[model samples]
Target: MTPHHGFTPFFTGDSYISPASKPDWLASALPTLTFYPKAIGVVWRASRQASSGRYDSRHWCESSLNIVRSLETVGCRLRVTGIEQLRKIDRPCIFIGNHMSTLETFVLPSLIMPWVEDLTFVVKRSLTEYPVFGHVMRSRNPVVVDRVNPREDLKTVMNEGGKRLAEGYSLVIFPQHTRTVQFDPTQFNSIGIKLALKNNVPVIPLALLTWAWSPGQLHKDYGPIIPSRTIHFAFGEPLHVSGRGTAEHQQIIDFIQGNLDNWHRQDSD
Candidate 1:
């Protein structure tokens, strides 16, 4: 379903899957060309809107939806499920997801903001410092962390994240320090769970596979776009954190890991 400022916030179902695509001629890019130019163009345009003070939440989401459509135009299929969970909640919440690539970071706003109010992310400080993209991100008022100092980053998230929740903003946090194709529980932290517990909000597990935009070698994030892989996002029901949140945190981990394992298995079959 196409998302717009005035349309129904959530699609008709708990899921919305992009229809399978036939081979597309546009999917063929020049062998020497990469995805950066196309992505930068989108970001650059959004940055201008933001700088001019014309970028609001609706505009922010629209830009993301544009990115989704742009990817589809190039032959990437999106399979989104459990999106109904976003609308089922009545209060502010925390979202914990496994970080895969830059795609999830850019794509989630459109999917989430329609159902929930004041959606924001806990991003690495560098993201808020990028050239054109940084302007777009800063306008959203995300919780930023330096990522170099664990104690400081924790303090930043807990303090800043707490304030945002108090103001009715939902937080999306990727506990992994860096984007990776493989899921590692040891690397995923309970920071989101802790923040939820502190603010007495629910933590929703967001499991996504965005390897279509793989992590780059030289730039780390400027990488190849693999249209052959289907991008997937699964939103689990919200879990309230209590009693140290041990069980809830584990449930979040299990949810993400289970979906990823199932998706990989299906691809193999």
Candidate 2:
């Protein structure tokens, strides 16, 4: 299938796209053929409910649990441990996790929504342009940052995150700042720690093993879902910011790397 604009065609081969056929036909039909209706429905319903001001944090928590359960029914399993660590915390925290896939975007909200009354994420400004998802994101009041201007973006994060924390909302941040095919220690950043330090909130290190389930493939005929492909969500002990600056940041990064390494090693064994 040839790519047109920002979307890929539904079918491949010369027969499908002839001189007589127009690109608009394929673009219009692709959304239905790819099951976008159902996807959009799910996103819309969840987002609408989450954005509704009538619901309290407890209500959101229950809704998130149901959402995760629904996702699992479709072969997406979330094996979560270290949940007890979060249960012991009495205050708001800045959750730091490695970015790997879109899985966490859906999963993390459900996992932590129940425990924390207010939960918001730091997302790229570009995502705000997406159709239904964008509407939901904005309604949910997430902190959107423009990566191009580092100075303005950092200022926005610190100012917005501090306000959210003060209001009892826990912030979930992808410290790597972007998704990658693989996790590398070198790519990790200390921005999350810096936010925690600035806001005087404890940092909770989260290690997610979620790249295994490749979602929304180009073709449905790719193959059956990979069985025994585990997705782990682990929460590490909270790290409190100390007088140490660079050392503290490095320690947080090392802590996340160590946890991910151990999780992978055990999975391999």
Candidate 3:
């Protein structure tokens, strides 16, 4: 838990995790069942604080980092790269990435907020309406979408997201309508790229491998977590959108696809 100035963003250098080397036999088997509740508890507390108007930007950032640190303490190691690229950007930009799982939704703020300071997400409308947690998310003033209507969602993101960017707020947008363990380039939308291009802001591509946080059978967020599964995030160099944004959109797809393929091979090896 060092200060943000000295933080390197990597919880552990090694991305490969071997079950044979695990020291805790009991905890290894029930990783998901054991840790997810605690993570939810952290969210609950944060939501309550936010709902009570006691939560500020600093508190929000600290709570997010605390959640990631707590998860690390419970055996989920993280390996983050390209943080220097984020630090180099003086102005706010739109962060576009593949939506893998709820893990990124919970953990990303810790990684991005410390560097950017002011950050929010383009989330599903239900997320902002979710009981208990909704208040916390709404407080951040995210661009909420219904998913049922792409046209309306795009309008909301363009209108709201553009305004936020104008105010120096960086946005994290998961172009995929839903989170999936596998990356599906077809389902990935170009709204984030369009927003960035229209706003004349740089688009920072993010690639994340968060399948370590498994989706639950009953509740997606509270799923099985393989402690031996390492979390990976790699941020690509910023791209300034030009013309129709088709090139930039494909570039983002390639960035995420390449990272996921490489990471999957490494983890399987």
Best by lDDT: 1
TM-score of each: 0.94, 0.74, 0.89
The sequence of per-residue lDDT tens digits that candidate 1 reaches over residues 27-107 is 556311434566677888899999888888888787788888777767778889998787777778888999999899889
Model 2 clash pairs are none
Write the residue-wise lDDT of candidate 3 on 210-235 in tens digits: 88788879988667777678889988
Give the better candidate number (1 or 3) by TM-score: 1
Task: Write the residue-wise lDDT of candidate 2 on 1-269 in tens digits.
Answer: 11212322222222111122222443334422333333445667756764564444444444455544444444444566666566656678888888766657766765666555568888888667776566666755678898777778778888998888898888988867567646777777677777888778888878777754354467321222332455677777777887745766676677667767877787789
1 or 2, greater by lDDT: 1
lDDT of 2: 0.63
Span of ten consecutive residues with least summed lDDT in model 3: 11-20
Candidate 1 vs. truth: CA RMSD?
2.4
Q: What is the C-alpha lDDT of each candidate?
A: 0.84, 0.63, 0.80
